[model samples]
Target chain A: MADPIDFWFDFSSPYGYMMAERIDTLAAKHGREVKWRPFLLGAVFKHTGGQPLPSQPMKGPYSKHDLARSARFLGLPFTMPEAFPVSTHQACRVFYWLESRNPRLAHEFAIGVFHAYFVDGRDISQMDVLEGVAGKLDIAPEAVAGATADDAVKAHLREVCEVAIASGVFGSPFVVIDGEPFWGVDRLPQIERWLEQGGF
Target chain B: MADPIDFWFDFSSPYGYMMAERIDTLAAKHGREVKWRPFLLGAVFKHTGGQPLPSQPMKGPYSKHDLARSARFLGLPFTMPEAFPVSTHQACRVFYWLESRNPRLAHEFAIGVFHAYFVDGRDISQMDVLEGVAGKLDIAPEAVAGATADDAVKAHLREVCEVAIASGVFGSPFVVIDGEPFWGVDRLPQIERWLEQGGF
Candidate 1:
C-alpha cells in the first residue's frame, strides 16, 4: 500500500468540511488512506497575511454565494452558521488528543465536529459543543474537556501548524501527496488524477 | 439563445490564459457564446485589496507550481514568462479599439495576446511584441500603434475595468452566467455543469 495522503484543514472552513466529507471515499477508491490533520487557519493566515474569505469586500458576498452553490453542486447540505469563521482551537486540540489514542476514532470525531459546525450550525469553538460531538462517538465529556485544556495537546497542534507552514500549507483543504501540495477543495479533481496516475 | 456568458480576465493571469483557451469551446458546446472581457486585475485588486498570486509568501511559490501542473492537466503548453504580471493597458486599448470595429477579430487578437504572453513567453507589454503578434494576424502595425496611443481607447479600457468592478469581478478568469459568478480555472467544471443543467 502507498503512503497515506495528508489532508490539512481548519475546522471552521466550509470548503474544509466539504472536502472532509468526500476525501476518504475518494482516496479509498484508489487504494489510499487519508490522514486528517486539523490545524488553525488563523495561525496560517498570520504568516500568509490572508484574511478569512467572508471578510473581504466584493469577494465576501461572492464567497458566501459560491459556498451555497458549491454545496448544492456537491449534493451536500450546508447552512451558513450565523457566527462564521470562528476559532477552532478546542476542536483541533480534541482531534489531536483522539488521534494519539486511535487514529480511526479521531477521524470520526473530526467528521462529527465538522457536521456540528457546518450542518447543525453549532459552534465547535465552545467546549460544550465539542463535548456534545465527542459524546456522540462514545468519548467521555471529561476526556474532551481534558484535551481542550491539556498543555500537551495544545503544543501538539502548534507543532502541526508550524510543520504545515514549513511544508507550504497556506489554505484550508490542502492535500499533500508524496510531497506534491494541492490547495483548496477545488483541487480535489487534480488530487484524484494524481492518485490515479501516480503523479501527473 | 440565452445571453452570452461574460468571461472576464486579465492578460497577465496564468489561470486566465488557461480559461481563455478552454471557455470558448466549453461554452460553444452548450450552444452559447462568450463575451471575452479583458480588464486589468490590478485595478480590481486595488478595490479588493488582493495581490498578485506570485507576490505572496508561501502561496507565491505554490502558484507557480500549480500553473505548470494545471497546464499539464489541461494538456496545454505553458511557459512562465521572465517578465510576469506585466501591464496590459496597451493590450486592452488595442482590444477595445478592434472590438468596436470587429468583435470576432478582437477575440482572435485576445487569443493572440494570451498565446504571446503565456505560451511564447513574449513580453506582450512591449509595443514591438504586440506589433509582432498583430502582424501575424494581418492586423496593421500602424493601427495597433494608433490604438495604444489613442486617449479615447485608453479611456474605454478604463471604463471596461470600472464596469468589471461594478459587476463584482475581483479576480482574473471570473465568469458570470446569468449573474452567477464562478471564479478561477478550477470552476470550469461547475461552469460546464451550469451550462448543461441551466443553473444547477
Candidate 2:
C-alpha cells in the first residue's frame, strides 16, 4: 500500500472545514487513505507574513462570497459562524489527544467541530463547546477537557505545526501526497487529476 | 448580445500570461467576446496589501510550480523569464494606444508581449524590447516607442488601473462576467461553469 495522503489544516479555516468534508471520500475513490492532521495557522502565518483571508482588504469581502459560493458549488451545507476565524488551539489539542487513541473517532470529532462552527454557527473557541463535541463522539467531556490542557497534547500539536512548517505547509487544506504539497481547496480538481494520473 | 467578459491582467503576472493565452478562445466557445484590459498590479497591491506571488514566502515557490503546472495542464508552452515580475507600464500604454485604432491587433500585440516574456524568457521592461514585440505585429518600432511614452497613453493606463481597482479587482487574471468577479487562473473551471449556467 502507498503512503497515506497527509491532509494538513487549521481548525479555524473555513476552507479547511470544506476540504475536510470531502477529502476522505475523494481519497477513497482512488483507493488511497488520507491522514487528517490539524495544526495552528497562526504560528505558520507569523513566519510567512500571512494574514487570514477575511482580514485582508478587498480579499475579505471576496473570500466571504467565494466561501459560500464554493460550498454551494460543492453541494455542502455552510453558514458563517457569529464568531468566525476563532482561535482553534483548544480544539486542535483535543483532536490530537483523541487521534492518538482512535484515528477514526478523531476524524468524527473533527467533523463535529467543523459542523458546530460552520453549520451550526457556534463559537468553537470555547472549551465547553469543544468538550460538548467530544461528548457527542462518546469521548467523555471530562476526558476531553483534561486532555486539552495536558502538556503532552499541547506539545504534540506544537511539534506537528513545526514539522508542517518545515515541510513548507504554509496554508490550510494543504495536502501532501508522497512529499508533493498541494495547497488550497481550490486545488482539489488538480489534486484529483494528480492522483488519477499518478503525478501528471 | 450579452456584455463582454472583462479580463483584467498585469503584464508581470505569470498566471495572467497563462490566462491571456486562452481567455479569448474560452470566451469564444461561450459565444461571448472578451475585453482585454492590461493594468498595473502594483497599484492594486498597494490597496490590497498583496505582494507578487513570487515575493511571498512559501507561496513564491508554490506559485512558480503552479504556473508551470497550469500551463502544462492547459497545453500551453511556458518558461519562467529571467527578468520576471517586470514593470509593464510601457507595454500596457502601447496596448491602449493600439487598441484605440484596432482592438484585434492590440490583442495580437498582447500575445506578442506575453510570448516574448514567458516563452522566450526575454526582459520586457525596456522600451526597445517592447518596440521589438510591436514591430513583429507590424506596428512600427519607432511608433511603438513614441506611443508608449505618450502622455495621453500614460494617463489612459492610469485611469484603467483605477477603474479596475474600483471594480474590486485585487489580483491578476481577474475575470468579470455579468457583474460577477472571479480571481486567479485556477478559477477557469468555475468561470466556465458560470458562463455555461449563466450564473450559479
Candidate 3:
C-alpha cells in the first residue's frame, strides 16, 4: 500500500474543519489513508508572519463570505463561532494525546471538536469542551484532562508544528501526499487529480 | 443576455494570469461574457495591508511552487519573471486607454502583455514593452506611447483601482458574478458552479 497522506490542520481553522469533514472519504476513493496532524497554526504563522484570515483587513471580510459560500458549496453546515480563532493548544494537546494511543479514535475526536466549534458554535478551546468531545468517543475524561496539561504532549505538539514549518506548511488544511505539498481546501480538486494521475 | 462577469486582476499576478487565460472560455460556456478589469493590486494592498505572495516568508516560497504546479495543471506555459510584481500602471493605463475605444482589442492586448511578462519574462512596466505588445496587435506604436503617458488614462486607471478597493477587491483574480465576489484563481471552479446554478 502507498503511504498515508499527511493532513495538517489547526482545530481553529474553518477551512480545516471543512477539509476534515471530507478528506478521509476523498482519500479512501484512491485506496489511501490520511494521517490527521492537528498542529497550532499560530506557531506556523509566527515563522511566516501570517495572520488569521478573519483578522486581515480586506481579506478578513472576504474570507468570512468565502468560508460561508464554500461550506454551502460543499454541502457542509458551518456557523462562524463567536469566539473565533481562539487558542487551539488545548484541542491540539488532546488530539495528540489520543492519537498516541488510538489513531482512529483521535481522528473521530478531531471531527467532533471541529463540528462543535464550527457547526455547534461550541468553543473547543476549553478543556471541558474537549473532554466532553473525548467522552463521546469513549475516551476517559481524566486521561484527556491529564493529557491537556502534560509537558511531553505540549512538546510533541510543538515538535509537530516545527516539523510542519520545516516542511513548508504555512497554512491549515495543508496536505502532503508522498513528498508533494498541497495547501488549502480549495486544492481538493487538484489533489484528487494528483492522486489519480500520480503527480501530474 | 446575462450581465458580464467582472473579472479583476493585476498584470503582475501569476494566478491572475492563469485566471485570465481561462475565464473567458469558462464564462462563454455559460453564455456569459467577461469584463477584464486590470487594476493595481498594490493600491488595494494599501487598504488591505496585503503583500505580494512571493514577498511573504513561507508563503513566498510555497507560492512560487504552487504557481508552477498550478500552471502545469492548467496546461499553461509560465516562467517566473526576474522582475516580478513590477509596477503595472503602464500596462493598466494602456489597457484602459485601448478599452475606452475598443474593449476586445484591449482584452487581446491584456493577454499579450500577460504572455510577454509571464511566459517571455519581459519587464512589462517599461513603456517600450507596452508599445511592443501593442505593436503586435496592429496598434500604432506612437498611439500606444501616447496612451502610456496620457493624464486622462492615468486618472482612469487610478479610478479603477479606487473602484476595485471600494468593491472589496483585496486580491487579484477576483471575480464578481451578479454582486457575488470570488477571490483567487483557485475559486474558478466555484465561479463555474455559481455561473451554472446562478448562485448556489
Clashes of each: 0, 0, 0
User: Comparing 2 and 3 by lDDT, which wins?
Assistant: 3
Q: What's the lDDT for all of these models?
A: 0.93, 0.89, 0.92
Error of 3 at A36 (Å): 0.9
Worst 10 residues of 1 chain A by lDDT: A122-131
Interface Cα RMSD in Å, per prediction: 0.8, 1.0, 0.8
Q: Write the residue-wise lDDT of candidate 3 on B1-200 in tens digits.
A: 88999999999999999999999999999999999999999999888788998889888888888999999988999999999889999899999999999999999999999999999999999888988999999999889888888999998999999999999999989999999999999998899899899999
By lDDT, the best candidate is 1
Residue A163 displacement in candidate 3 (angstroms): 1.1
A best-first ranking of the candidates according to their DockQ comes to: 1, 3, 2
Q: Is candidate 1 or candidate 3 better by lDDT?
A: 1
Binned by DockQ into CAPRI classes (incorrect, acceptable, medium, high), candidate 2 is: medium
Quote the positional error of residue A132 for candidate 1 in Å. 0.6
Which 10 consecutive residues of model 3 chain B have the lowest summed lDDT?
Answer: B46-55
- Per-residue lDDT over A36-71 for candidate 1, one digit per residue giving the tens place of the 0 to 100 score: 988989999999898999889998999999999888
Best of the two (2, 3) by DockQ: 3
Model 2 alpha-carbon drift over 4 Å, by segment: none
Chain A TM-score across all models, in listed order: 0.98, 0.98, 0.97
